[model samples]
Target: MTAKPTLAVVGATGAVGAVLLQILSQRADIWGEIRLIASPRSAGRKLAVRGAEVEVTALSEDAFAGVDVALFEVPDEVAAAWAPVAVARGAVVVDNSAAFRLDPDVPLVVPEVNAHTVRTRPRGIVANPHCTTLTMIVALGALHAEFGLRELVVSSYQAVSGAGRAGVAALRAQLSLVAGTELGTGPGDVRRAVGDDTGPFPEPVALNVVPWAGSLREDGWSSEEMTVRDETRKILGLPRLPVAVTCVRVPVVTTHSLTVHARFQGEVSVDGAREILATAPGVVLCDDPAAGEFPTPADVVGTDPTWVGRVRRALDDPAALELFVCGDNLRKGAALNTAQIAELIAAEPA
Candidate 1:
């Protein structure tokens, strides 16, 4: 029998990192030993896994030694600095940040929609796209293949957790303020009452939605917005595919949801699109308006698959379809997807 593969998780004490470890525990059959790596600040931190405290070690080139798969959830700078070293030390790196998603040699993958790209990682670094894009593509990729997606217009309602633990805190704090918990107001009011809290964001994240995420780059588009356009095009291999996206931060704790409208080259009836989505892998059909069964972040948190609901056809556009999708940003959007990629890569012949 083949020995189980060794795995290392970078940023193992972080929000996504924590979930990644939990996922590995839940999917324990695929792994042998688990190594948790983090920055020096987290080196002494002990993360409890399966009722055992695993000491977090400082991530370095040596951390990758003898590891078969390294899943990174650190900041872009750390992943950018250390992933190559990890690869040099012989580990297949499945990165969860935006660091290499658009890199020419690295493949941007969402396993359900673009698992083939995960296998094309010649440099041993496969990038997980932004959570919003991952959830959108899994739902849209099915329809794109069947009806020929011509154009896509997407708006995202991203959970605070996507920004990491701090983002979640800000939202909770805001809701606390909103509930008049401590200061007779909600969490957003607290931030506003004391200037602003910049833990997860530069500005207050309570009761308000921020249109911007990531740093502002040249041409006035923030990195998050550009990722939606660039990464989606690269993964789809359609640089000219007309796609427009607006990513926003919402008060939801987990599960990044999307409202997508796609115009297909060929006419696709609402029933036809529904049929396709119902049978797609990694996709759960929740589109029942009459029964009030629609996908929502509250309903999809902790779930494995992307959920789609509220399917409708535009009265004026015969070739267009509209739908809402909810996917656990931490699971399918990050950790679980990366883990699935590691499992798939292991299946390939060396």
Candidate 2:
């Protein structure tokens, strides 16, 4: 490794990819060459990074030749096919897709939780956790380190942006159509208003919430729900931790919020929980209900750290704690985390 590494941002034209570019430019400099790669349609387009214009190149085998680190933000299928090619070309791939997250050989990492695992990547690839899991696990992982977490019951209020640009556009269009109308008053009114414009959601996400995200699985759990369970376990190193999750799509444009009830092996307290989160890396403690303080998607959008509030210990259960957390699904949940991981790799000893 050198003092500065050549970096490649794959899928540089998508939502997360655009955010990743902004994050890279805003952060400190540790990269040599920053290459932008996208599909043929986006090739030759100019994107501003680090205060300079960079031309997007079509993703190809030659694109990875001199790339020391490749940060992928493409679809699962695209990543599954191209990541190995990048790795074969000698670039360590930090993929932000689900394709390799559960692969035993690939390290699914959150730098705040399991950064040391970065060096043990047997396949020269690291997987970023799902945006929902990334949203809450920073604070949860901090508390788990102290209280020894045993189980989790979590419900997520996710924004439309989690589904990408189309999700955002659909929500905006529906909101506009129903802005001054009476849609939420009757059943199917909102759906009828936003006809054929639901975008990536199964139903209208304006003036109402959908209790589903991701594809339905055989076990009745949405793929989004299952990701929260599985990714939390992997990141926390607890395979049998007993996690239950329900994912809901809210009308918000960005940020994902979660209400978590965590059970620990030992007794816990509200003050202790507050103290841990106040000092935890990648966490911001914003709990003060008297002054009307709590983490909300409105307050967390475009932010970096995971905002945690409403910290309380279960009244009847001394070994349990309850809290609310919010994170920008596009920032810490995806882009910044991968950027941090790539920086970690850049700092590795030569």
Question: Cα lDDT of all candidates, in order?
Answer: 0.83, 0.93
lDDT by residue (214-325, candidate 2, tens digit) is 9989779999888888888888999999999999999999999999999999899889899999999889999999999998888789999999998988888999998999
Which digits, one per residue and each the tens of the lDDT, describe model 1 over residues 225-338?
778888778877778989888888776889998899888997779988889899999899997788889988988999899899988886789899989999999998888888
Candidate 1 accuracy as TM-score: 0.93
Error of 1 at 131 (Å): 0.8
Model 2 C-alpha lDDT versus the unseen true structure: 0.93
Candidate 2 ranges with C-alpha deviation above 4 Å? none
| Model 1 residue 334 CA deviation in Å | 0.7
- For candidate 2, what is the TM-score? 0.99
* Minimal lDDT window, size 10, model 2: 181-190
**How much does each candidate deviate from the true structure in C-alpha RMSD?**
2.6, 0.8
Looking at model 1, residue 232 earns an lDDT score of 77
